[model samples]
Target: MTTNYKTSFLLPHDYEIPTFNYPQYVLPPVPYNYQPYTQDIWSANVIQPLKTKITAPAQCKFDENKYLNLFSGEFNECYYDFEIDLKEIDPTIQSISKFQDAYKTIEISNLNNLQIKCATPYIENFINDRNVNLTYGNDNCEFDDGLLSNITLKKEGISQTDDINFENTITLYTNNIKVNDIETKYAIAYTNGLPSGDYSNDYITKTKSNVDFLLQVTKLSNNDNDKIKETYLQVYYTNDVKLKIRFSKVLVAKLIRMFGYLYWGNDKNIVIDINNSDTLGIKNNSDDPVKIKIKPR
Candidate 1:
């Protein structure tokens, strides 16, 4: 019975586990084609084209034939009359109806052709060297007439956006004949941490007792008279903070006195010349140390 049970316990020989076949995974081929990048037209290229014609503004052309330099005076004879004819750069621009001071166009004196006509010789001498440029109107044109269709009239050194403060005194030594006179007493304040250069312009004017017109300050590293002429307010700082100013031309002083500060650039900083003055004096009113090379506006 045991042998029969063992024989019955044995499993069928044909019965076996099933097998599965998985498909092969093949990768795709790498790409071979390439493309180049391109850019569309820029706004500047579209708006402005190369080789485009530009209209130029009319300028004052120098006239050698009409140029005159006369010398006349009583005792101290100096170069008196300096006359020049400024024709338009465009020969076609003729019959100028009106002309005025280019920068300060408000001072219209019914003159356009000639620039300078000073009574005294020294004054003429001072003005002739400056070589002022003028703007004029055509026969049927107004004061605001233009030469080029696209360009606007530009007064080079004049600023329309500046806040100008006008007063009676004009300025201290620069304007007032009474105060600016050689006899008149001028004083400067010596304080720690005061403004210098263009910033000091207002500060120097306000801090001083008799300053009526605006005062400009410049820094001087060397004692050069030629360099001094290059600016209105020249400054040099030392261990002792004292103001050392040298004036040159009386004619220049008078011109500045009448016309106010002559701006060199658009900022309206006054332009000065040492050659315009005759008397050279040095004075020290304060003991403040010299602060050199402060930038001016």
Candidate 2:
């Protein structure tokens, strides 16, 4: 067995095919550096230096107060001194002279000084002279003189006084009315088909007329006599084509009225109170077990 190993056959070698080597793709350089740029480069080098070197156009300032005071007088100075003895002075002549002096002394420098010192820039100036007749002066002159000949002074107190008095009187009168004297009327209507249990499904119908719907009334008194009142009503019904079906907890109560009375007698007028809760109940099924309780007023 050691000498018989010489008869061997040569077999074809299975070799793997070589793949194509694609060149490594290099990315193009970015236009900007990837690293974050610092603020010193943007502010000092780009923005601040340019801003510091550029000079802006100067803005012209026009002092309104200065202009007005220069043309007028001291800010708070009254146009006319009532305390001054004018009995010996003719008002017409004095007014004429004041007008002349005002027209002559219309300068901006004086106006500016007056504006600087006065709280209000609306200053007035006047000069007095004899032998000239004066009918009336300007607005500022009138204001300074406290002579509201042309202007209508609003009497806020007087206008409000009547309203206050009327409100009080009406309120007092309303405090005496009774609750039951206030009456309200409402009309309601609905159609109901008969239940299948009662008759054949031939659409039997029933209607109720002027049913004495009961209402409950409550009186809320602010004082012993001034009473606010509320009225409530409850209603119920149901729809049945075959057997009567009761709606699931679908009932609503509504307040009909919150009223105030002007008098406590039988003929008293009722004023509706805007603030109160009133409710009414609606039942969709007549056969459904429902209870309506009308409490005494």
Candidate 3:
């Protein structure tokens, strides 16, 4: 069967063929709407597939559109809030330099005996001393200057990190040779060799292959009178494995570059397993036409 491509997915309503392998890397819609479905075709970024729903509705019918999880490189630089599938990204990365400029200060009470501990992979150590005793108004010390000495930090360096790609942490400890009152101001940042770009935060690239994992559109289809009440869509990606699917009726922003398209046979039985979903229904009007929009995220 010949699948004629338009922009994103091959024309769904009129097209029918055996399970065709349409590569999902988002690309300019091919002017020539046909590609061979070779057996060896496989996308590197694959979202896991789902089982068909049973018991009542043979296929999923919903009034709303949905979305899947795309690894976005946008978030806070201090903590990891989400997990970007490593498979979704090219992991063999080297730093042109690192990112993240940090500064902190800790007031040490009970200086008679004190122990503050921390660690970092960027340097053998961020502190010159790990164990010590002191008085309230006598000792003020900074540690980023002295190290096992392999890596060096600024005079105000407290910890070394690579926020350039992702957030890494540096730990500190207070150590020996102190007399009285110590005010430790850990004013630090990693900036000397940072790559030159507006992009100073962790991110993915346009070069890596991008693919849809799974696309699920849950709809509530009600007969015009006493049948089922129709619903609007809210799409979501299922990461059971990681390849993703885009949905109809809504557009989302993607973190990865766009390329090839995800084509399908006549089977749109793509329903996902979502819990606690807020269901919204539209009166399945027997008159007006309805349409769903699929977008990338």
lDDT of each: 0.19, 0.16, 0.19
- Alpha carbon lDDT at 206, candidate 3: 25
Model 3 Cα shift for residue 104 (angstroms): 17
In model 2, what is the error at residue 296, expressed in angstroms? 93
Question: How good is model 3 by TM-score?
Answer: 0.13
Each candidate's clash count: 17, 27, 67
TM-score, every prediction: 0.15, 0.10, 0.13
Model 3 sits at a Cα RMSD from the real structure of 37.1
- Residue 54, candidate 2: how far off, in angstroms? 27
Candidate 2 lDDT (Cα, whole model)? Answer: 0.16
Q: TM-score: which candidate is best?
A: 1
- Local lDDT at 33 for model 1: 30
Candidate 3: where is the Cα deviation over 4 Å? Answer: 1-69, 79-190, 196-257, 261-297
Candidate 3, residue 231: Cα displacement in angstroms equals: 45
Instruction: Give the lowest summed-lDDT range of ten residues in model 3.
Output: 96-105
lDDT of 1 by residue, 1-297 (tens): 355443445476657768788899988998433221111111111111111111112223222342211111011211111111212212322322211111111111111111111112222222223222222222211232121111221111110011111111112221121211233323222111112222111111111211111111111123312221221221221222222222211111211111112211111112222222121111211132112221111
Distance from true position, residue 156, model 2, in Å? 48
- CA error at residue 83 for candidate 1, angstroms: 41
